[model samples]
Target: MLSIRAVICTLTCLLFSGLALAQATPRAPGLTFLYSLNCTLGASLPVGAGPNGNRVVIPITGGSFKGPRLSGKVLPLGADWGLIDSKNTFSADTRYQLQTDDNAHIFISTSGPAQSDGFIHLRIKFETGSSKYYWLNNVIAVGILTSGNGYVAIDAWQLTSPTKA
Candidate 1:
C-alpha cells in the first residue's frame, strides 16, 4: 500500500507539472488588418555627399489612397530627405499631407531604410485634428514601400493588440 501511494503521488505531481508548464507558455500577438496607402515619389535630386553619406531630396508629387476606413488624396509640397550610406542602404525621411474626400486634413511622416532589393520598410505616424479620424493620431503603423518608374507606392498597416480586437 505504501509503494502504491508513492507511485500515485508521483503521477499526480507529474501531471500537475505538465499542466503548469502548459499554462506558463507565452503566446504571440496577432496582427489585425488595417488601412493601406499608396504614394507617388517624384524625381530624386542629388544634394552632394555629407559626413554620413550622400544626401538627396525626393519630391512627393501626388497620389491617392483608398482604404476601408479612409480614402484621400496625397497633397503635394512634401519631400523625402534621404541619405545613401557607403553600404548602399537608403534611409528616407518623408513628410506629407493628406486631404480626405470630406476635406479633413492629415499630416503624415515616415522614415525607414531601403536596401538594394528596392524595398523600403518604414515606420509611419499620423497627426490629425478631425474627430472622424482621430484614432490614427495614436496608433503604431508599419509600411512597405516600392518604387516603379516615376512613382512610389506604400502599403501601410496599423498594429493592434489581439486582445483589443
Candidate 2:
C-alpha cells in the first residue's frame, strides 16, 4: 500500500504531465504561395523494370515560371527520372535549372509520389548563390503537378510558421 503523501505526489505529477502535453501539442504549419512552373517535355524514354520499379526518363524541353517574388524560364537541360513501383505509385524525381528574367541561375529538384486525386504531390527544393533570390535556399516547399498533352504544370508553395504575418 502506498503512503498518502506518495499518492498525492503521484497524482500531482500525473496532472502536471497531462498539462505539459496539452501545452506541447503542435499546430499545423501554414503555406505561402511560392511560384508556378509550366514546363514543356520531350517523349519519355522507358528504362525497363528494375529491382525497385519501372523507370522512365522524361526530358524537360523548356518552360517558364512566375510568382509574386520571382519569375523565370526553365532551362532545356533537365529531366525527370520517374519510377512506378509494384504498388502502382508513380514517384517523380526531377532535377532542373531556372534562369530568372534578370539572369540569375537557380537549380531545383523535386520528388514526390502521385496521389489518388491524379495529382503528383511534390517536395520542391532550390539552390542558388544569387543574393536577390537566395531566400529560396532555405524554404520548405511543396508543389502539385499536373501533366498535359506535351507539358507539365506545377504550383508550388512554401511552408511557413503558423504565426507568420
Q: Going through the candidates in order, what is the number of backbone clashes in each?
A: 0, 0
User: In model 1, which range of ten residues has the least summed lDDT?
Assistant: 24-33
lDDT of 1 by residue, 9-107 (tens): 999999999999878445555555455666677778999899989999999888898788888899987999989889978998898999998999989
The TM-score measured for candidate 2 stands at: 0.91
User: How much lDDT does each candidate structure score?
Assistant: 0.85, 0.95
CA shift at 162, candidate 1, in angstroms? 3.1
Tens-digit lDDT track of model 2 for 1-165? 999999999999999999998895577799999889999999999998999899999999999999999998999998999999999999999999999999999999999999999999999999999999999999999999999998999999999987733
lDDT of 1: 0.85
Question: Deviation in angstroms for 66 in model 2?
Answer: 0.5
Error of 1 at 116 (Å): 5.1
Model 1, C-alpha of 25: deviation from truth (Å): 6.3
